[model samples]
Target: MSVQTFKPSVRVGNWNEDISLDEDLLKDFLEKREKGELLLQKSGRLKKCILQKVELSFSKDGFLHFGDVIMLLNPENSEESLSNPSPIYGNYTVSVNPDESALSSKTQLTAPCGISGISNVKPCARNVFIITSVDGSDYGEPLHYGQNFALRTRDGFMGHLYLTSDQKTFLKCCKKSHLQEVSLTDQPSYETCWQFVYLDPQLRMENEGVPVPANTKLLIVHSKTNRCLAVLRKYILWTFFGKECEVTAHTYLNGHKAEENENHWIIVTGNPSDDINTMFDRPKPPSEEMNENKCIVKPLQK
Candidate 1:
C-alpha cells in the first residue's frame, strides 16, 4: 500500500492561506542568513543554524538583541509527528529516551487552532518536526522504530517542534501571556537580563529540615501560598522539559558549580543581598537615634 502524501502549507498564520515556497521568499531568507541576521554555529555534532532567538532591547535606538541558546534547527530529513494507534480508544504518551543527545538538543512545536478537520502538516522551510522512527503495523504505519527527530520542510512556516529548550518558546505559545514590546530605551525587558534566583538550602532547611539544596537555581518564581509554589514548579517542568525532562528542586544558589551541566541553565539574583528575602524585599531605611534618646527604626511599620 502507498503511504498517503500530503503537501505542506506555508501560510503566514494558517494552513488555508498557504503560499507556495517560491524563489523570492527563499532568496530573501538566504540573504538574511548570510547577513548575520540569524545565529549560525560553525561546529557541533548537530548541524547548527539558528533561525531566531528570543531577543530584547534596552536601547532607545529601537534595535533588537537576542539572548543565548540560539534557536538551531535539526539537519535531518523530513519526518511526521507521532500518530496514536487504536485512534478511537488508546492510552499513550510521547516518551523520549533519556540520553545526552536528547537532553542536550530540544525543540518545541505549536500548531494553529480551530481545526476545520483532521489534518497533517507538512514541514516548513528549514524547520524540523519530531516523529517516531519506527512504524505501527496495526495503525496502518509500521510499528516500533521508537521516537526520534527530523527536520521540517526548509521553507514551511514554523510548525510543531520535536523539543523545546527554553522559556521563551512557551511564552510565544501561551495566548493569555501579556506579551508587550518594551521600548528599546525603557527598562530592559525579560529578554535582556539573565533571570536567576539564589537558592540557599541551608536557609530552607533551617526553617524546615528539608534536604533540598539551595545551591541550584530555580527559575520559576515561588509564592507565599503552597498552591502558587506548586504551580510554579509545574509550570517550569511543563514549559521546558514537558514530560521528557527530569527536574529537581534545589535549596541553595550554586550556578557556578553547575557549569559542567552546560545543557542546564539557571536563574539567580543579579544584585547583592545578604539574604534571599532582602534581595526580594524593599530597601531598608537608615537607622537613627530619636530626640527622646531612644533608638528608632525609620519608616516604622504600620
Candidate 2:
C-alpha cells in the first residue's frame, strides 16, 4: 500500500491522547515510511531539474549559447527511439553493475507504475549533457560553425564526448556518446573535440560567429577523425537507459559518400527551475509501449 493510503490512529483535529507523541519522533517515522518504498532516480532526485522535450521551436535565445546544460536529440530517421520487444516497466531502483563497463548502470525492479507506457520511466544520465570548452573558458560564448568544442554529460556521470579510435576499422560508430567520457578538464585530448557542420551550405547561416540555434538540426563531426556522430539502430544495446541505438562516429560506404550519412542531431537546453525541464520525451514504440516485455540487459549490442 502507498504511504498516502495510510492513516494515523489519531485524527488530525480529534486527537484525544493524554500523553502526546514527540513531534520530532512523529516526523522521523513519517519520513522513513515515505522513503521505505522509494525508488531512487538520479535525474529525478535533482533538487531542481528540467525535462526538455523535442519541438520545432524553443523559448531560449533560439541560438544556443555555450556552457548550456544540454541534451542531444537523436534523429528520428535513425530509428533510435523505436521501442523493441522489451520496454521499461514501472518505478525502478537503478543500480550500478560492477560487471558492466565502469560507466555502465542497470535498473533493478521495485514498483510497477501500472501503466504500459515507456514515457513514464525516469530518464537516465544519457539524456543530459553540457557544452563546454576543452579549458575552463567559453562559459558564456556563442558557439560557431565548424569550431572545436567538448560535450560532456551533465547528470554527474562526468564523461566527455570523444571518438573511439581503438577499433579495427578507423570508421567505427561513436560510443564516445554525443562523442561521450574522459575528462577534458583534466587534460585536453583531440579525441574529445568536435565540430558542428552546418545543415545547409548555401545559407552559411551561423558560420560567421552566429550562435547555433536551439532545436536546430545539424551534424556533429569528431575533430580528429572528421567522422560524423551517428546512432546505429541495428546496434541497439540494453543499457541502464533501456534499449537504445548504439552511438558511433562514422560515415557508411553502402551507397553514397561519407557526407551523405544521416548524422543530424538537435541540442536542447534550459534550467528546470525556470519551468524548463531537463527531461525530454524519450522515443516510444508506435503501439502499446508498456512493461509487457522484459528488459534486455546488456552492455553493448556487440
Candidate 3:
C-alpha cells in the first residue's frame, strides 16, 4: 500500500503572513545578478543585501523580534497596539552572531528590567532576602574543596544573602568546612555566589499571582546545576519524633521533585520587631527608611 504525505497550505490574510528564507531569496538574487538586474561584489561576496519587509495586521501570540521588525507566525486574534513595540511595551531586541566558517548563527534575546516576559531577570537587589528552608535552615556558607566551592546552608547562623556583582547570581557570607564540620566567617566573598532564579512564571502564576510575594509557594533555584532548594520532610519528622527518617530537607542539586513541602521558604527582612509571618502579606513598600540595601535577615519562627 502506498501512503500519501500531507502538505499544509499557507494562507495569507489579516492574521497570517509568509516570509521567504534567506537561502531562497539569495538564490533568486544570484539568478537576477546573472541577468544583470542586480550588482555583486568583484569577489562574489554578497555583502549588501536588502530584504523587503513583511507586514502583519495583528501581532501573534509567539511573535519574534528580528532587529526592528517583528515576525509573526500563526498569529492569534489579539493585535498589538503600536506599529513597533519598544522595550517599554514588552518588546525587546534579539541579537544574532553569525559564523561564516561554521555556517551557523548564535541568537540571543534580551528584555529590559522589570519586564514580566523575560526569564533572565536579575532579582531586585534593593531588598535582599536571606532565603531559609521551611525546616529553619539558612543556605549555609561557601566551603572550598579545590579551586571552587559550594554554597551550603547550616542551621544556627544568619545567612545574609545578596546578589553577586552580575546581579543574576546569589551569594552569601563565606564559611570554611572541614570534613562534616562548618566554620563561619565575618566577611562575604564571591566564592559564596550562586545562580538562583525563580521557577516557571506560568507555574508560579497558577499557584500564586502576579507580583509574587517572597513567602508564597515559590521555588528557590540553583542556577548552575538547575537544581532547586527543597526541604526533606523526613528530616523534620525525624527531628521531632526520632523516627530515624532520612535527611530529606536539603538543597536539591539534582533534578528531583521528591520534597515539595520542604522546598518552600519564608523571606524575612526589615524591622526585628515586626512579625515575620505577616511580612509577606503586609510588605513595606520601597521607601526612604526601608531602602533596598538595608535588609535584615531573620530566622524563621517556630
Which scores greater on lDDT, model 1 or model 3? 3
Query: All candidates' TM-scores?
Result: 0.17, 0.50, 0.24
Model 2 TM-score is: 0.50
lDDT of 2 by residue, 1-302 (tens): 65665456545653635225567668767785576422343324321222333222223555665676565655343232344433321121111111122312233211110100112223334344456676455576777777788765443333333222322233432333333211223234676687777765544554645567665566777777776765444543454435544445665443433244346565655434444343233333454333211122334445
> Which ten contiguous residues of candidate 1 have the minimum total lDDT?
224-233
Q: Which lDDT tens digits does candidate 1 get at residues 1-302?
A: 99756645333454443344455688877886675443332212123222332121112221111111111111111121134332211111111222232223324212221110011111111222122121121221211111111212111222322221113243433222212111111122222222122233234324232211111222222111111000111121131122321222122223644211111221111113333221112243555433211124465668
Decreasing lDDT order of the candidates = 2, 3, 1
lDDT per model, in order? 0.22, 0.45, 0.26
- Between the candidate structures 1 and 3, which one is better when assessed by TM-score? 3
Worst 10 residues of 2 by lDDT: 109-118
> In candidate 3, what are the lDDT values of residues 82-170, reduced to their tens digit?
55443222211111111232111112111111100111111121112232222222333221111122222211111222222112222
Over the full model, what C-alpha lDDT does candidate 1 score relative to the true structure?
0.22
List candidate 2 segments past 4 Å from native: 1-59, 78-124, 135-137, 155-187, 204-208, 252-261, 271-302
RMSD of each: 25.1, 15.9, 25.8
On a 0 to 100 scale, what is the lDDT of residue 98 in model 1?
Answer: 22
lDDT of 2: 0.45
